[model samples]
Target: MNIDTIELKQQQLTYPQLRKTQQYLMPARLTGNSGQPNGYDIYPVAPLGAGKIFTGFDTLADYIIKTKAVLIDGFGGVFWDKVQQQLQSCFNDKDLSVNWIYTETFLKPTGEIDALVKPFLGADDSVWGTKATFDLIDLFEPAIEQQVPDAKFDINIVIGTGAALAGWASPIIYLDVPKNEIQFRMRARSITNLGNAKVAEPFQMYKRFYFVDWVLLNQHKKNILNRIAVMADAQWPETINWMYQQDLEAGLDQLSRSVLRVRPWFEPGAWGGQWMKEHIDGLNKDVVNLAWSFELIVPENGLVFESDGNLLEVSFDTIMFSNNQHILGKHAARFGDEFPIRFDFLDTYKGGNLSIQCHPALNYIQENFGENITQDETYYILDCDDNANVYLGFQEDIDPSDFRLALEESQETGKAIDIEEYVQIHNAKKHDLFLIPNGTVHSAGAGNLVLEISATPYIFTFKMYDWVRLDLDGKPRPINIEHAFNNLDFSRKGDKVQQELISKPQVIESAPGYQLVHLPTHADHFYDVHRLEFDSSVTVNTDNTCHVLMLVEGQTILLQTADGTQKQFAYAETFVVPAAAGSYKLTNTGSGRAKVIKAFLK
Candidate 1:
């Protein structure tokens, strides 16, 4: 799972010959009618194949009956209560309505768990950090056969199949909401039944929903979602659509030759920047600042494919599962079933500094998080201020033990450590690629717009320091000094860091109007980086490997596929050219020189 392996050693990894030795899985892109003038287009299936591609008057009850499941286990973001009512009315079936069970009924009182987590409310612990597990059987035994919630249990006696318990395996139906909508609903307190509590503050409830529920539960329910019967987009009636998993795979197969872009969601954070809010179109402007944009984050990002002039979104995992080799090529065999590369924005323009953090080494991430790959990442400077500086590795070595003591004392006393004394600083400019392998202490200093390119294992940043800044809610953010110290490589100090970690771009190829610069990374880095400096145009081949493109320094550019199909992207826009897309031509539509960063398997 380490992307570094996917980069250097994956050339030897190859998938079995298609249909030669394995089960023949053909292209099965989902196609549907939207009642428009145009014809049908391929569609992405909902996450876990739990929802449907098209809405109908009556289908939920029939689907349950057809699938031969006693109950329909639907779990998702806020507003499920109201969504259930809407589904009941849509189905118009008393039989189906009477069999559904809301998980809230099966809860032990909130006081027991709340008391344990209360101490770390303003400290450095997440709900998952607590050694507490609430199984459905333990809490919902009393409500098993009762109609307490006005729904009689299906006599088949399928127990606790909703949550991520051992016996929960039926036709799962996952309802989903966008991040913006979920946050809004949580803040508005649209519905109660937050595990154990009836009511809580907005920010507190938000933490439970995101950190506890989503992050901690995603892996638990991934198996159920993998073979889901239906996935609902949760937009009732008009736009609400349920998509099948097989159909989604089929749709992805059909799109092997086309480009794919997920509808990115934006979030405003405590150390957020203003670039996204000022430039990115179709974002909620009411937010104070947009810190992170999940540009190519597959697990969380949703895919959008237009069918008959109507745009429908599904989880990006559809293509990862269905079009594996076609999208990832050789790395597909190495990565098996995961998309290895990630493209995300880190905007610090006119904002504060990011947390000084480091990711665990490969073995640490694997042993601790049960992950196959570590987050091997690189930060390509997309834009930056005149005085922008990036924190990487450490300054000239002093004492590793002393550094740990200083960090701990700062955490205990609410005092800020002088970051420069221990951390190395490098001035950043446009197109400066800083190599941040796992365990390299790094941070995106303020006044720079960074395009973080890496193997997608985000959320593992073990923050050692946060510059003594408070969160958006005015509470001190969490810092993991112990975890950071355990993973920090003091050997990556002063001279070795600059000579090994910091990238130095070399012009590998130069022509009249085009030059390809090789931005060499660390030996452990599984992915390679390159800058396509072009004047008028340049032709780039996928080489049977997926290529992620970013318009780092240009107003706009055109990507022309082999079929002569073309797509234009503006400045700071990120897009992907699939492995099946073959060779594509890039025409610089801007006035001056254009630099597009192409990242893929080495």
Candidate 2:
């Protein structure tokens, strides 16, 4: 076919590939299951089939028509009505309908795999939302049989978690889209497979769409032309994913180019990419503008301990590159620079005592520590033993000498610090959140499980004491004895331990998650938190600027309208709701109450 002719029919035709066509014409051949008496055996399909297959379609319209878009409404997640309405508005043809399918009846996947949606036409359609989660190859194999029953396409859209890919064990299928799509899908798949085991971001795995763009579009195919781009303006995810892929392929050369062009610096101790300081000296400093910045902190690689301790994960600086790029492009549409979104993450793994230390006063950090010190931290306990305890602020007067003595003794004896003298201890539970402000003498006890969210750049850790855990090489880790001893604020001691309230948090007027009460200084960045209850919807205003919304309880839909355009965000398990999402409403449609937290810049 001529290029023009192919372009004309590309939309409707089964994507043209001579090799794929050959497989589509192959006969129904069963290899491993031939001897089975009955059809009760389950063949573990490859994630990406060993050989290519063909899909039958002649025109784009036919392709879309025969191609079903399965919407599996996972439990604990919500699909906004506005999103439905907006998505519906895009189609000028009135015949097309967006069907809302509830997959609640089928046994829900316990942890991560709460729901699964497969768009099946013909024979495959019956299985389309049949399971809470399923392997993409298995789901599509039958579809291929139904569509191109006589032939196979080299490329097939394999939908499922990363585990599903493993479940099928297919190897070497090239994904056409950006890496993040695969990452997101793999993330979702993992969660769904867990079923209902308190997995976070349950629906994230399925929301990502991966296709072989090279086979369809040219190398220079603009993202704006993608099907998803037609529906939503959030193209950064795809762009970022592509950049990540570029970095992977291009490596140091790309890094050099990035430095020369932007004079940018990566965060120190970065996890996925190179560390920050190593590349700082090579960056170009005379650029007209700096587009993005990433940041992170990594512990010494071989740090080890015999007793239980909390490991602190620091977000590398370059994180801003991702969060800011998205915000400037997406959030700026609604909340402008006035509302800068702050992104912070500490990928921590705890080992032993994180001294009973809290942040210094906000003013203290800003004035003494400099303008970029915002130390209010929120922890979503990631994993912890059943009886682990953390000593948050003190219950009563704790003599400085006594506290020091306790730490010294703990270090000397390799025992947990005597929290009884300085503070009361609360048994740490899984998924509980702790709001640790500056100046609060808190220590994360043994068996730590926490995801910390904080603001700004300053590591003012006035450690009270360390249980003298040795490093991996069997040497003792350093302790901040002088600093810890000097910074302990024994005044206004708080009730040592208090029960955590994880139930649908009480939402007040204009709050998104939890209200962390603390006064802020001029340079301090913070968000008023609110916990959203299921069934009960809340109307939020981004009067200040960008708000970072996290799903703490359940899934939520952040409906946004921009310049007469509206978008709905369903299955936002733990995704960020940009400040530009505008004056939107949050709804909880999951079986249980939705617990969403919103943090907006103030």
Candidate 3:
């Protein structure tokens, strides 16, 4: 992804100004005001096993009145009141009592678990080792098996909050929430400090553990959603659409075009960059640096569907739940219905460098993080200052034990380790493709806006060193030397690092109007990347596999499908074409040459 964008001297609109403009242009929101809710009509995004999804208050009430046990699992921050009220209505309908087994009942008092292992354990491990916190089987199974009493009720509903995965009940209802929304609720509602009952020295411990909890919660949600019969958007008091996989497939068949873009969520971080804050319209600039744009992490991403010009947003998982053959194709066994690739922004432009980190190996990640896949990432430099560089691998020949000791000592003492003595630094240029497979140590240096494309396991980074920098909250970030050591492949050091990890582009295919440059990925990588240089337009085959694209260099362009349906994209704007969408054309409607990067499962 080439990010050598000409700095436009256009007036910078304030967040409100951009928002007002966007609101005026956009149609009526599909969210808010549940007017004649068409939800529950199609849900679970796909079919679960062979059983039918029994929904509607009356239907559930009738089932519950006669049923033995049921389990409903979701994030606690989502609509507890609405859930309770609706369940009560169902019980009131037949004058039948119901059993509610909330997993919160079994939580250990606060401070019982020291989750403050690291302030920045990447995305996955930061959520604490939840397995060590509590035993799911021991705490929330008896009730699931009907051994525990149901408060003298006819039916039992076990509300498993990441406490248990295999609930002893048929048809688990999994409620999914975008991660940004969860954090938003965390701030709006001062309910952090979860699982902590006893007093502690620092209040920020809860906040520190919050990220880890978010990570763990998401892992549990994703895993549980896999076995669920029905999936619902957890946004309560709003139109939570019921998604069914079969319906999603049928729905796609009907649409001539599907604009695939997740509602991007922004957050300020200690090492947040200024590029997004300055360039991305409608973003609040008054806050600290803009660090992360949760572009398309499905478990943390929601999809917006337009119905009669009403933009209703649902979980992105629904797209996968649809189980469209075109999306995954031959990779269906590996990724199943879940989308396998993730596209996000890592802005270090005029900001601090990302923590030196490496992801766990495949089997190691599965065992430790509960993710079947690992994060094999690539940084396509989108926009960068002339003096930008990326840190990768280890320098020369350093003692692994000494490196570990230095990192541990840095964590103990506030003394910053000389990072260069350990990690290799490479100059970063616009469109430079840096491959970071699993167990590879890497960090994007300052002054570079990076388009981070990788496998869908967004979390699970084991941050080894943080340059002794404190987080925005004035707290020291985490350093997971132990976990990093376990995952780090020492072979990804010295000269071999450049030879193998850094991608070199070569013209793979070309024509009069277009040229495709292959940005060769590592052999272990299951995905491929390419740069499409086009003058007017270039057509490409989806080959029954989904494609994620970004207008890295162009000012603007149109992505048109075979049906002539067009969606305009601008500089740095990312979008996906589903496998079922088949063939599409990218028309470079912008001035000058347009450079776009396309990534898909290999």
Candidate 4:
């Protein structure tokens, strides 16, 4: 491609739909509990892809020459198909022919091409006379044979289903550079399991507990795949016959019995000699030498690089699973197909009683000339100190400007708020439930361990105040005063949260546990809070409903597998079990009382 031609074509490639779609996804307004609706409230699921929407036109073709750029950030179907059809019609003119670009950040193909083209097309690369796009011949045909190793191929495919959109095709594409040669790294996409770790406990260990939901790693010119194979058998817990009930336990327990102490993750020696034989030791030695290892692997946040010396390579992209449209709230894409929304349970080690500041209302933020805000949070106070004081909402009506001044002062002077202005501060107790509507200023006071259930996943935090914890760089983080000020409403004072116990709230003998309405939404906002307490083992048959089981007080075994096979979790630990776990048992194994919170859409 000539630079002169690129400059000329750049101006002609104007994508109008791109601009419109970007605006459509950006969260433009905030929403409140019971207030006037704001005009700018845009609750787009994923707004980061707001910039890449566009289409490519052929410019010259006889019939309805169809070539278009379908930019899908996450999951797209009827909505996108309708948009694609409209674009096809728009570019069907005699003078203009349509060409599809299909631009998508989350899409593996787009990311791969972008990653490959970036280095060669980069300004620094021009000094070496490298071009932007290379043909297949140039990409694979190595300059030397002895320097490179054998290449291995891996492919994974799955069907995507959605409510608003059905039959949406989304597939994972993975390509690994040949091993046993000088290489940068290996990359993969949408990988379900990589049996790289050592799993010795079998049924006694927890599966997918590490939170490494996705992986992309790099190794030197060694059989990295073979290393991975050794790691897999030792890491993941698969099913097998068990003579006793203990055989149905997690593998971690089995390993713990041998090791005497339970460890968080695998120890280096746990890989054993079998794993060491597969060049694992040699690869480990070589990995530290690489200058740069790029694995466009999507972890929690984004891209990461691991190296084992030799040459350097780059990955295409990385995406967090929570943000992954296909598996956002579902156990997996298959379960998500049946249930669109994914209900997640978060156990913040430090977010117990000393909670952060509250967010603003959607209407106030949108109308009052401020940034977009989404604030709807609920908490199940599983445990709290006897004298713990949880402050929430305002005590009395106040001038909005005064509240603004208070926020400004907090931002400038490190003060949270004018303590005098706080509305209803209550001493929160254990087993209490609270509904925090948008715009209400509240925090989970210190020493209060709780289960938080919220509306959306995005973090629209307005730091009213902090315990004054300095950042790693030793700087006080700036607060968004203007936005937080607009959200605070002094008129409505929220009430204390109490467990709704109607003696034996309507019992569902068919269902496992009884639903004790702790805090009703009252106004159908986000979710209905409930406390599920049972003495005997309860059978919960999941029908596409994912649950975040948090053991507050005692140990409970989540019987997931068919028959009696299950994984046991103790207090303070939380598990996001898939609805596919099907009908499982929640057996109490601890000595004392067992308390847990069950949050789902009713």
On TM-score, the leading prediction is: 1
Global lDDT scores for all candidate models: 0.64, 0.33, 0.65, 0.32
Residues 1-602 of candidate 1: C-alpha lDDT, one tens digit per residue? 00122221222123222011111111112223322111111122212232325554255445654554433344344355555555566445545433455565565567754554443233434422321234324434354434332224332213222433324445555554544445444554553323554656665665555444544344344545565666556523223545565665556665556566565666677888898777753344566777887787776776654432323455566566557788887678889667888999888888888999999899987766545688888988888889888999888865888888888888888898898999989999988889999888999999988899988877678888898879887888878887888888888998988898889999999999889999998887888998999999998888899888877877888788886657766677667888888889999887799989889888
For model 2, what is the alpha-carbon lDDT of residue 131? 16
- In angstroms, the error of model 1 at 52 is 11
Ranking by TM-score: 1, 3, 4, 2
For model 4, give the 10-residue run with minimal summed lDDT: 229-238
- Write down the TM-score of every candidate: 0.75, 0.40, 0.72, 0.43
Give the per-residue Cα lDDT of candidate 4 at 298: 14
For model 3, residues 1-602, the per-residue Cα lDDT tens digits are 01111211121122232121111111112223332111111111211222323234455445445555666676545655566577668687767676676666665434344343332333442444422333333223243343354557776676646434434645665565555554544544423434544323232433344445544554455555446654555543423434443443445443313336666666677788899878875454576787887776766776654433233344565556444455666667767766788888988899989999998899887676456678999998998999999998887786889989888898888788888998999999999999999998899999988889999877577888887888877887666788889989888888998899999899989888788999999988889998999999888888877788888886888788876666667777667887767789888877888999899998
- Local error of candidate 3 at residue 172 (angstroms): 11
Q: Write the per-residue lDDT of candidate 2 for residues 297-412, one digit (tens) a residue.
A: 11100000000111111111122222333333343444321223333322222234454565656555444433334465655554466666666756667677777777777766
RMSD of 2: 23.7
Residue 552, model 4: Cα distance from true site in angstroms: 1.9
lDDT of 1 at 43: 23
Q: Regarding lDDT, does 2 or 3 come out ahead?
A: 3
C-alpha lDDT of residue 400 in model 3 = 89
